[model samples]
Target: MLDRGTTSDDDDPPLQKWLARRGKMSALSLAELESCKNYTFQLGRGPQRCSDVPSGLTNSATLLKAEKNSPTKEGLLASAFFASPGDGKGKVRFLTFLHQLGDKKAVVKWDTAVTRGMLYIQLPEDPLHECSRDSLVELLDVAEEFSSRAIVFFSKKRNDMKQLVRTFKFIGFDILPPSCDWIPTSQEYFFMSYEFG
Candidate 1:
């Protein structure tokens, strides 16, 4: 594990100050956050698979099938795959947890996808007490409803990488280098595909 005691030459700006006006903290600044001793996800590939499999984002058809078969109300709505909260139109949306590489703690979002495998915009975690462990359980419950397998978290932050290495030892995923346009500040971003052994 990385040491938290190292002091930087100067006190870096608070994360809030560096975030985009809409609320996204700079993905590049994860390294700075690491200096503060907080744990966050790293960018990189996940575990490996038995046979070769594509590492890119899962398609809409697959996502829809996953949603329809999901056991939980939340998961059935495809909230786990989207980046925005609640379905537009005010209906309760899905909850998502994003582990930005090099930052501490995962960010929870209410989100939607712009494309099949990409998010349009990821909303910030709710400051109110609504998003506690119980909320996470509720979110997973929906996913469990349809998904036959465990939901895997993919991260690029070093800490997240460690967590993945620790938690998913039995599974296989591929950690691939990100594509050209996806410039993440972390050393690498990870791609996790669910694997069952």
Candidate 2:
């Protein structure tokens, strides 16, 4: 298990905003909250079929299916898949998670493609809270949804990487060597993909 002492971080803009905004939430009830900051779904092949399948992105068809299946959802919609290299070769993986920002909700589709030397992992704006145990589980669910053979995470900032790695490790993910060069970054970013056992 990971040590979740406090949701406090100096480099986290969400945490910073959390500290600056809102009143005491001690009396706040999660029961009143209709949705979660991070919500997950299963699409395409799950981790169990990773070896027999591949990795890709969550397509519109799947999103439409989800919309039709459930009519009353308003939060980050995560669609995961296993995709082969953009060239029909190489390897790719996928998973998704959500971050609370405000009352506003949006659907973020990670239509990322891994190229010879580049991997595009696009996400929505920053989150509104620190990564907690619940959020970590959501992340794993998303990973398994993609049927990823292995999970990977990347962050420009070492601190963010440390925090992310801690959370993932607590949830049973291990660090793997980089398959490609990770660009040096001043801002924080995270990329994690898990392999199916």
Report the lDDT tens digits of candidate 1 across residue range 1-197: 22111222222232223211112222434343323321222122334343386534221111111121213333213343232224321111232333222233543443322221122222222332333333333333332222222323333444445654544444343343445222122333344333122
Return the TM-score for each candidate structure: 0.24, 0.35
lDDT (tens digit, per residue) of candidate 2 on 88-157: 3333222233333223343333323222222233433443144344433444343332323333434444
- What's the distance in Å from true for residue 172, model 1? 5.5
User: What's each prediction's clash count?
Assistant: 32, 18
The C-alpha stretches of model 2 lying farther than 4 A from their native spots are 1-128, 131-133, 142-146, 179-193
Best by TM-score: 2
lDDT of 2 at 164: 60
- Stretches of candidate 1 above 4 Å error? 1-93, 96-141, 144-155, 171-188, 195-197
Model 1 has an lDDT value of 0.29
